[model samples]
Target: MITVKAPGKLYIAGEYAVLEPGHPAIIVALDRFITVSVSEATLQGTINSRQYAETDFHWRRSGDQMIFDNRDNPYHYILEAIRVVETLALEMGRPLKIYDLDINSQLEDQGGRKYGLGSSAAVTVATVKALCQFYELPLSRMDFFKLAAIAHFNVQGNGSLGDIAASVFGGWIAYSTFDKDWLRTVLQTNTFGEILASEWPGLKIELLHVPNELELLIGWTGSPASTSRLVDKITIAKFAEHEQYQHFLAESQKCVQKMINGIRNHHLPIVKAEIRHNRQLIKDLGFFSGVTIETPALQELCRIAEDCGGAAKSSGAGGGDCGIVLTDHTVDQARLISAWNQQQITTLPLSVFQLTEASV
Candidate 1:
């Protein structure tokens, strides 16, 4: 059996604005991961994941396509990964074969509540990695990332795909989104192999080093939010408030750029200040767009962290999920966590997942 794992991620700075091409976002991969294991099988292949569903999903290969016994399985990302990887395999003159894929996840809490830790992106990347190993493909990190991004975009159809980058690279990263409009137009005439080999406009991913004096903390609101839904609402608002939206995007870019510099230069003060500034920018965005990007619970979470002399903000689409805090080692972390507990927020113990040379 061949096994692979991908880490979940959180947006540290850039959120909604990162959707625009060339706009930068700072994201970090968490220690939590999604694992996929593949083994050879005869007749039919099975996909089993107790976290998603109880019953096994069966499939058979027909030429270069996969025909599933049941079409209503909750493995859209995984299935897409298989389709794209198999397409690449066939392009390389490799014959298809049946395999059993088993998946396990640690992106959720004890009650199976998702923490908005980019589980879908992690699973997609993990499946792609597992299949690449099973097929013995000579794929590089960038090639693997592009394949997984293509599979994810086919299903999601939106977002910056920064989560996919963090899952692929596994560390603190400064990422700029690619031009989705360009990809959509070129995909009509170009083959997957051609596109994979081509340069994607505005796409950038750089591993970062955090300052040694900084400490990161995560607090879960115990409520999940749909990132796509929030992005959809913001999309509509973007059309209605074009000028204001442009201003938001410009300011977000500036804030994220400074935050990236702070991380790169080991300037903790600038990082903390930019975090607070980004929080306000998102709040103003919610006010004008009527999207409620930050919930009251998230507001409380940030306020408590600020009271403790740290910087905090909603991690992702907001609405509900998790908030991240960045502080110096001198801050009283236990008191901050205890205050969060009083407000019914759960402080999650998570660390950054760094990639080694071998893994890369």
Candidate 2:
């Protein structure tokens, strides 16, 4: 059996500013992950067929076709991922065919849904990693990153590519898009397969559970918020006022230093402060409609986090899947968790780690 454990992630800085070119964003991989295992199988259908069992799923290969089934949506996401690889293989004139393959996964956060962490990206990374092992296909982290990006676009219609990049490369990364068509990248990624691998280590992050005991409250306004809509909003907003956008970009950049200080010193205050300011900036840019953030449940959690001396903000595209919070006192974690429970919201106790790789 081939087992791969991949990490979810949290964006530390450069939230909306990443839409502007030349801005660098920082993220940390979380202790939570989506684990995948592959074993040689004797089954019917195709080598690429998928099946699910509880937190696990299997994909088997038949003679020439591929099939997929899974207990988790992430598997559907992965099946979309493999189609990307197949397209690439065909483009390169090295068409890949499956004999029979099985896939199983364990995602331990938000009942296996995305809670602001890169769940889709992590699953995409694992799928590619497993495929690499299954076919003996030699690929670098960068190559896998590109493949995951394709998968991301397939699933979400549009994505920043930041999450997949962090999952595949790990550690710290700086990614920016200067114009409409170009992206610039620099990796301080933590992994075992690079020349500077010996010097890079995992980043330290303290995960806080807001006391309310609510399973992370996700308030969708009954419709999914399209990422493209948000991105286009920012694009038009930027051109109308470069000076303001430039200033916001510069202020957002300051979060990088704040994050570094918080991580290095284990100072929760700095982290909380940065999160508040980051959320405000994103809010100021119109990512939050007054109504979405105004939802009673969401507003309650935000108030609870603030009351508990923590900071909270919307997670994904804001119309909501989840919101991320950072707390001040570890001692108050219980109180915070209890508060969420009382409110009937979900609280996930997650740890943050910068990207790094295991010895293969």
Candidate 3:
């Protein structure tokens, strides 16, 4: 048996703007991980889990296809990972191996509450990693990231794969979105061998350094949000090319650059100012898109964090989910945590996932 693990992820800045090719976003891989175990078993291939055992998935192989007799299942990411690996193996003159996979996650609480920390992305990455190891595929980090991303995009239809990239390469990263038109071309070809033989020019992933004195605290609203749904809503709003959106994109990109420079220089004040500026810019973008990017709880979290002398912003799509706070060592994190608790927002205990091989 082979096992692989991947971390959940969050956005530090540039959430909506990174959907376009040139705009870059900051992402942090979380400490929480999804684990996948692959092995041969006596029964038909099954997805076993402690938290989700009640909703287990079992399928049998028919020729090169995995037949899920009961088709209405929730683990589309896992299912797609399996299919993608199987497709690649068969095309490479290797047999598609049949195996039972056991999956588990620390991203969800016992009460089944999701923390909105990119559980799907983590699972997709872990699943692909296990399959790659099992099949002895000679894949580099970018190659692995692209395969997992294609699996995720096949299921979701749209994404920049920032979360998938973060899960694979942990810690903080500055990432540019892949070219969707080029990705769609590869998808149309549906040939893994072609992907193996080609170099993808549209994808960019870079590791970022965080100041040792910097403190990042995450506050969850105790409610889950849908990133894909929110993206769709913004898409339907059709402000992609609007003049105001261009302004927001331009300004937000500048703020991110400023934050990057501040971190590199260890200038906390500029970092703080740019974070708040980025937050306000994102709030304004929500206004233009007519979506609640900053929900009441998230806004409250930021107010509390700022009151404690830290800079804060709602992370990710932000209808709900977590908000992030950044400050220096002098900030009263205890007071910030207490105030968020008073507002019914739970503070998440997180460390950046630091698997450099995965993330670098």
Candidate with maximal TM-score: 1
For residues 1-360, could you state the per-residue lDDT of candidate 3 as single tens digits?
A: 998899999999988888877787889998999999999764478888766767858888778788885665778898899888878877777777678889999998779788988998999999999998888887877777888988999999876789999998888998888778787898787598687567665567888888888888999998898899999987766456488888887988788888878877878888888889989998998898888999988999999998899999999889998999987888998898888888999999999988855333
Q: Select the stronger candidate by TM-score from 2 and 3.
A: 3
Comparing 1 with 2 on TM-score, the higher-scoring candidate is 1
Candidate lDDT values, in order: 0.92, 0.56, 0.85
Worst 10 residues of 1 by lDDT: 63-72
Model 3 misses residue 58 by how many Å?
1.4
Instruction: Count the clashes in each prediction.
Output: 0, 52, 3
Error of 2 at 9 (Å): 2.6
Clash pairs detected, candidate 3: 169-358, 169-359, 170-359
| Candidate 3 error regions (>4 Å) | 356-360
Per residue, candidate 2 scores C-alpha lDDT tens digits across 24-106 of 56565556666666655456323332234433444455433465564344356767767766654544456465433354333
How does residue 327 of candidate 2 score in lDDT?
52
Candidate 1 residues lying further than 4 Å off, grouped into runs, are none
Report residue 212 deviation for candidate 2 (angstroms).
Answer: 24
Candidates' TM-scores? 0.98, 0.66, 0.95
> TM-score for model 2?
0.66
